[model samples]
Target: MADEEEPKTAFVDESAVPSAQASGEENGSLGNSWSEVSDMRQGLHQRHVQMISIAGTIGTGLFLGSGTSLARAGPVGALLGYTIIGAIVCNVVLAVGEMGALLPLSGGIVRYTETFVDPALSFAIGWNQVYSGCKSTFCDKSGKAATLIQWWITINNAVWIVVFGSVMTVSTLLFVRVYGEMEFFFATLKICLIIIVNVTALVVVCGGGPNGVATGFTYWRNPGPFVQYLGIEGALGRFLGFWTTFSNAAYAYAGSDSIVVAAAETRNPRQTIPHAAKRVFARVAIFYIITIFFVGLLVPSDNEQLLSASGTAASPFVIGANIARIPVLPSVINAIVITSAWSSGNAGMLNNSRYLFGMAKHGHAPKIFLRLNRFGVPYCAVLLITLFMSLAFMSLSKGAATVFTWLQSLVSIGALITWTTISVTYLRFYYGCKAQGIDRNELPWKSPFQPYAIWASLFFLVLIMLTSGYKVFLHDHWATESFISSYINIPIFLVLYLSYKFINRTNIIPLSEIPIRPLLEHAQRFPEPPEEPKQGWKKLNIFWN
Candidate 1:
């Protein structure tokens, strides 16, 4: 699956000036395609793009759910799981960024898939994302399983739901610059929290706390590194525990694709996106990997608090802090995480509307979704997507709550399906260039390592998807809900793809007809201005630069 045998491919160089530029054709193929001339406002700045990638994925999942991984896999096992997934996620984002640099289309990978692969594929993934994005935002972080939920007053879920729903709706419907800035501020706070947690954990590990007990590698050696998951013994149990964390780590890294999610709304996307892609991995390494390492060092996996469903009280940082006799950290982490939840929801809403807009543009969704407001936002799409926020109020009725659970079940596998489809689409694009004798360098940004990164990423992603519900098959673990949620999307995606393909009579686009040249020429004809070089103190802002 990695490579194909060399066929009689054309060797003619496509380096000459494209016909559109040579003829000064203003209304040629460049302006007609969906990838070109988006009506979406280009208001997201370079800093916004950079921070979107950084903060979009760092949510309560990292702050709270990370404890679950440590409990299951112990310290060393959990660290390995996050590290492995982090590397794969880096590749996934790079694949999206490479294409986005050239096309900079709205709907991120959805638009890219339609152009490089089959429109049917895009239709399938695009709707999948819309459904998942809308539902996940409400389902996420709303669980009662938290100790630090400092709600000012217990109010009706309906009222709070309406309030949050209104916020998401209004923010996305406004000028995109406003949305970008909101994300920028949220990302900055998340960054600071991670830094604080990591530093605090490191200090505690080094005996900086009142306990004055420097217990370096103490937890690792006492209970050992690997855990005997599900009461199974020895290496297999340890390996299973370690592997389960992949799913948890994946949840933590779920939204790394934000760099290209609103590509059309980004200013100077060609430069901004590639730079964001290159830096995102480093940011993840520093933030997630290093933080996880400290988590392992500071907290023992055997701690019962690690398994508790409580909020920041169960956060590994808080648990570690308490072990070192620090008390105020929980409130601090809790306060920021509430905002993070809202921020994550905001991102989901923005992404949901954009995906619908992209689908409508590609003729896969209702035409109304294409309607834009004075602010250049897909207002119609925003309204339609927010309808799902009503699901939040369903918890009021027991029967309705049951239905909501099943609804949530349907979207569990969406992220895995999304990543797999992205890899497949990118592979097609990578080879299409080869089959057409086009140089990759001709494009605005070419990701380092041809096919290998994506190929490896695809392999691991498929493995994770296959094993996602493995626990459901274990002794006494035959859960109907879990099984359905894990595997149902497989047939659903196939149905969406094959149904669209048969009805529309679509075929896998041949490499030669994939339209790389037209889009490349279009990009060249309207090249983005080169980014100005950094000067003086601005150079210190490495993360957002």
Candidate 2:
């Protein structure tokens, strides 16, 4: 008050001030100077980046959870459920690609939110993702009680979380050079495994292998093509059941946004992000849909293996393997499912670290997180995220399977919120671009249908949220406590938003002063060619270059 605190300004002059230098001026006396921090090394090639994105989205959910979804909705219901969800997911990818191709920063959704939406929105999404990722390990659901087999399964999952987390953490700490190579190898291995399973299934379907047979489409008719549980109560029961099944299916597709998190690490994000986004949608839809399609045709949804009273590995995939009389395939698929969970957790850790970093940069987190290690890794932030994740693993002590289901519910809410925000942000981005007189054609990647796509996506997201919580209001047989817990994410987000507003004493900015133009321009930094080669033979001959 002595000097009458210099009037706070919303807009800074980029031309007059350097970003690195301005860090100190903007936030006085911050410990580390941004200028001294070396730029991150570009290590991930386009191919590796794309595949990692692909692997991140396609996880154990499809391999394992699809069976549960198929059982709940039958073949036609499952197909329709995923189709609708897939459309929404694709729209999200498009919207995300539009923003990411421009920004291509490591901060991902958090960064985008900060730029286009309110700072509070950014904080909410970042914190929610961080919380979600840290708690993911406790969600595995393959264990029993007392029996040696059950004890082994529980111990196995626990060991997996620690070992996988440590390995991924150490690998991430290495120079980007090593990290990129390892991720590429891991992603390729996983992809190869998927192809093997798919091809094996195809061969079996076409009467190629030992247990071969053209098993026509008899299974569908055998099961009567649908499994109706809603009774003939009316449209209400049917509607509630549809929502319940859709929510379950959406959980299977929850990690689709993991690709967006890798934007910062990729070499040429503008060129690579769109390709990766497209591949994510295509792979998820085709892989999951076709696999389930075959499963429906091969094994009835009501088959004992597909609808085991116990929800362990007794899913349709496992059942299909057993039905085909394939030796060792069931075990192989189980192992791959575990690895898929590990990969998903690994990606989650990476994502949370960046989200933490973004929050710190935006003044919502401690300044310590903004400091980078010599390798340009945000070591403090990574360590913090890991610690949180480790603590989250404590939920496993309660019960891994139960914990996983709860976590999945939270994941559904988080994903829905994030997707909806992406759409809203895109709408703002579009109008800002137009108002700024920016040429959409000149942008490296433009989302098709503009405002319409954004609006449509937003509409679907709202529908999902409402439908997701519908069971709580209508189903007397369902546990009220469980229903409330499942829908808690909605209230949690509201509380977070309101608390942030109270703390900051802030009001929504007027539409005219929203600062969307600058944000849109900032996001457009993608598509620019890198100043140097990232890897391969070109990297090895740097001296000659």
Candidate 3:
């Protein structure tokens, strides 16, 4: 591959780009922008990258939350909800993959925001995601705090909180391979859990369980495939309930950008990152959609346990197992779910810290965060962001539950905004490539469906955000909590973007001014190593490949 030479492509000056400086600070702790993309060590191997994506994407949200979705939206509505959200998330993964293959930069959407859109917007998204990302980690870790109690373990939550928190923290601080292997083990457990859940559901659906009731489609017929929200009998209530699924589904698929978040630290990223992205979407999408379909068949929407707040408590599969009179299944599902929560927390921490590190390198964050550890991680950024893990402790507080709920709302909205930003940023990159006479074929990876797919993702993401709190306005259904939680992030994002724009005095970059050619040419010069042939079991190992 290196022997083949191509015609020269013209490069552009980055200074012409908005708020983009190519130089590192005088101290040199912060490396040159494009030269080292935060200088993270490439400690993650091919399998590590794949497992991280798999482990992070499959979490408690899918394990237990699907039951609640079924209760609110019914079987048909829940299936529709997960399907639409999964498609949108798949689009996001594609967009991010295409960009990451070419740019191979850390910070994920934040880096792409600065390069393709505007640096100021990058500042907004970077800070917003940092806040919300930590909140998500809080959600996952707090879920773990509830795990012991949910399984009747009788352990002190605060004590286990420190222990879980310490394990997650130490894993991130060490060599990245340590994090990768740890997630690999967790991911293996998660996959096995999913297979078990699905198999058990299928068996019960076919009347193979202890009771052998053979209720095939019986519940769907009785519940009639839709819910009447707030006792508003008729199609209007069912429609409202169906609409609520988008919010719920969005919460489950929040971190779609994670696969490419560590491009700088991944081995052979041009190949590794995008390959992981493409496969992750397909695998994760099917896992959510098919699993939801099975869930609908196995459990009824009106079951009271579906109303439980914790995923383990409200898990449809667990409920299904209970219906089939399988006593050990609940504990098994609960154990797997505990691991899923911890796995997601590991991913959340790793991605958020990398975002901070990239922001520091790009002058959007404090330079102090540029400092890296001996293992090549941004130790300072990890240390600073780790403080937010304390927020998870609020879940243990009796009165802080409401505050935590509001924070979760804000975090969910933040995820919607993030996917929306990704769509917009990729659109800009697409047009900029066209304007500069760069061919998509020449890029390291090209996404199919182009601008149309991205536009659709953007459309649905906006619609979901706008309608997130629709229930609050449904005459006589107003709730202060719903109003605050639903629409609060809109103003917050606008204020962050606008305030940073005015304070920094930056302009929205013109398509012509975007330095796409330079980055593309850089990618051309430093090509990734050709992928080696897989032998024997590796070729047969469909899951990891």
CA lDDT for candidate 1: 0.76
**TM-score computed on alpha carbons, candidate 1:** 0.90
Mind giving the per-residue lDDT tens digits that candidate 1 earns over 1-545?
Answer: 11111111211123432322122122212133343233556778789888888776577667776788899998899999999988988898888889999877778888777778877888899988987777677655333212234334455556656666688679888888788888888889988998898888778778887799888899899798989999999898999999888877877777778788788777778899998999877777888899888988988899898876344556787788788888787667777777777788888888888888878766788878888787778888888877777666654555543443354445446888898998999999999999988899999999988699999999989988888879889998798877887788888889999999888776677887677887677688777777788899998888766
Sort all candidates by lDDT, best to worst.
3, 1, 2
Candidate 3 per-residue lDDT, tens place, 401-519, comes to: 46544665676798999999999999999999888888899998998898999998899899888988888888898999879888887888899899888876766778886877767
Off by over 4 Å in 2: 1-13, 16-38, 137-157, 207-209, 230-241, 306-312, 389-400, 507-527, 530-545
**Cα distance off (Å), candidate 2, residue 26:** 6.7
Please provide, for model 2 over 138-157, each residue's C-alpha lDDT reduced to its tens digit, 9 standing for 90 to 100: 24421211111231264543
TM-score of 2: 0.83
TM-score of 3: 0.93
Q: How well does each candidate superpose onto the true structure, as a TM-score?
A: 0.90, 0.83, 0.93
RMSD of each: 7.5, 7.5, 4.6
Report the lDDT of model 3 for residue 329.
Answer: 83
Which candidate ranks first by TM-score, i.e. highest? 3
Q: Which residue pairs collide in model 1, if any?
A: 146-311, 147-311
